[model samples]
Target: MKLLLDENLSHRLVGLLAAEFPDSAHPRQLGLRGASDQTIWDYAREHGFAIVSKDNDFRQRVFVEGPPPKVIWLSIGNAGTSAIAALLRSHAPEIRAFARSAQEGLLVIEKAPL
Candidate 1:
């Protein structure tokens, strides 16, 4: 699934996770740095991207609005980029399944196994 990495994530993650998340991109790469959450939400909806973020704002938005574009909420706080990448890689299958599902709106990835 294509992911629009929120500004809170390192832009380098785009490259780091590219093999698995082909065509994934960050806001800064799309001239969307500093854009409001709603703006990013709209862009992801428009572009068929699953929004990957550490921000709770997006999670709350999904809870309220439901999904046109799904959300993968990274709950791993204060982790390094490599740790983030590894977490994502470890959960890749689940994330892809979540993306494909019509019923589920949010997938939260925590620091420890859940």
Candidate 2:
């Protein structure tokens, strides 16, 4: 699934994760630098993107709103961009599986298995 990186993430991550998650984009690159959560949600739903973030807001939305635009919430705290990218790349297969899964809307990834 294509990823819509939240503004909370570094815009540099777009290029960093491109090898595994091609076509992934960041809100900053899409003229959505300061867009509201609702607008980002609407955009991801309209297009085909799974929102990846460290924020709890989107994850909470999934419990109430379900998927069309899936969510990959990075539970790792205060990590750098490369480390975050590595975490995502290491779980590429699982992420792809999550993309195809019918019932799951949220995929939380932390440094330690949780």
lDDT of 2 by residue, 1-114 (tens): 799998999999999988898999999889998999999999999999999989999999988999978999999999999999899999999999999999999999998655
Model 2: colliding residue pairs: none
Model 1, TM vs. native: 0.96
Residue 74 error, candidate 1, Å: 1.0
lDDT measured at residue 47 in model 1 versus the true structure, 0 to 100: 97
Backbone N/Cα/C clashes per model:
0, 0
- Per-candidate Cα lDDT values, in order, are 0.93, 0.93
lDDT of 2 at 30: 95
